[model samples]
Target chain A: GAGVSQSPRYKVAKRGQDVALRCDPISGHVSLFWYQQALGQGPEFLTYFQNEAQLDKSGLPSDRFFAERPEGSVSTLKIQRTQQEDSAVYLCASKLKAPGQGRNEQYFGPGTRLTVT
Target chain B: AQSVSQHNHHVILSEAASLELGCNYSYGGTVNLFWYVQYPGQHLQLLLKYFSGDPLVKGIKGFEAEFIKSKFSFNLRKPSVQWSDTAEYFCAVIRRHSGGGADGLTFGKGTHLIIQP
Candidate 1:
């Protein structure tokens, strides 16, 4: 793909129902990130991966929030026991490589709008 | 913990008017700053970035930003805004390479700009 792509432009899930969002980053990119944006709010960092390594998950709000980048090319963000407060747009971004000592340009996807009822 | 603040929630200006949007971040170490713009029904796109060197950095579409290290601020500016420039703007900060996880960015709440013709 020419740019990062997120699936299910919009999702509606019943409270307590689990949901998973997918991200396909630009081919060969080494860094991937996931973020959550509330209405009228900035996107908050959720997690970060570097070539299959989940280096940071500090931004995940709860234990139910989990992310994985098994092969390093694709990533998934899964929320268990979804809550109404979880409703927000999930953004995915990828960079050509790790940020440090290199050009750190992130290309963002259109984002997945998730609504938990 | 690092965080970003964008004081203005909404701003209205006439076309051809000069514009400046304020952004502040809290971080003790070195940081990389970026400005992103999101037009209605569109994805977020980078306007400009500042990694090092001169404090002033120019970006696409005649947009520029100045990074003030002492104030921990990165303010975006445009000599003249057009109707098409109406959109939401985001400011972000990335931990220096030494801090690691450079891919993750902490973003401001974002400012909605409305350029009326």
Candidate 2:
């Protein structure tokens, strides 16, 4: 089975430009998550979605970050204005069940590395 | 706020050497623990998780982690490591969301393991 996958494996964006990263979760996964990993650091949570509802966005760094999963399978994380601080690897993960359903494993994607210059 | 700590930032061991990486988290409430591995050039993959039941949980590839609630720790151990086990290991925790709401995972700084054959 195909695992979670993110598009645009690498991206270089100018400081004020907008960028959107896409994620395709596993076929039947209803829970999806986003994370950010800076160099020499582990990934930090970004946001989470259950089906098409954005359940948690507390981890997002700032208001410039926004995410949506309209169809519940594919998600897009859009940054309103790229910044040098936004340079990092953006990871996407998906789980088969919602929180507290007893499953705890989340399959991750290759992640998209974004560099803002 | 919950925070995870990985005691070792980097570990180097020869093939067939015993390995143990320490991880501790700070959160008084109920939580779930997980260990994830990321091989070079690959996505993050789950090694194991501890939600309930026995404290010792075995994961893929000869790995096991013990959750010590009293100590606020979930340490990953392997009797003997292989060269292929060289990768980045991360310890993560999530607050138990029982009824409905969802939350994001809080990950540690991660351990970079280098195996020498």
lDDT of each model, Cα atoms only? Answer: 0.91, 0.92
Q: How well is candidate 1 docked (DockQ)?
A: 0.84
Q: Poorest 10 consecutive residues of model 1 chain B by lDDT?
A: B94-103
- Local error of candidate 1 at residue B69 (angstroms): 1.7
User: Measured against the native two-chain assembly using Cα atoms, what DockQ does each of the candidate structures obtain, in the order listed?
Assistant: 0.84, 0.79
Q: Model 1, range A1-117, lDDT digits (tens) per residue?
A: 799999989999999999999999999999999999999999998988989999888789999999999998999999999999999999999988876748668899999999999
lDDT of prediction 1: 0.91
lDDT of 1 by residue, B1-117 (tens): 788999999999999999999999998677888999999998889999998899999999999999999998999999999999999999998843334545588899999999999
Q: What's model 2's TM-score?
A: 0.96
Model 2, position A44, has a per-residue lDDT of 88
Candidate 1 clashes: the total is: 0
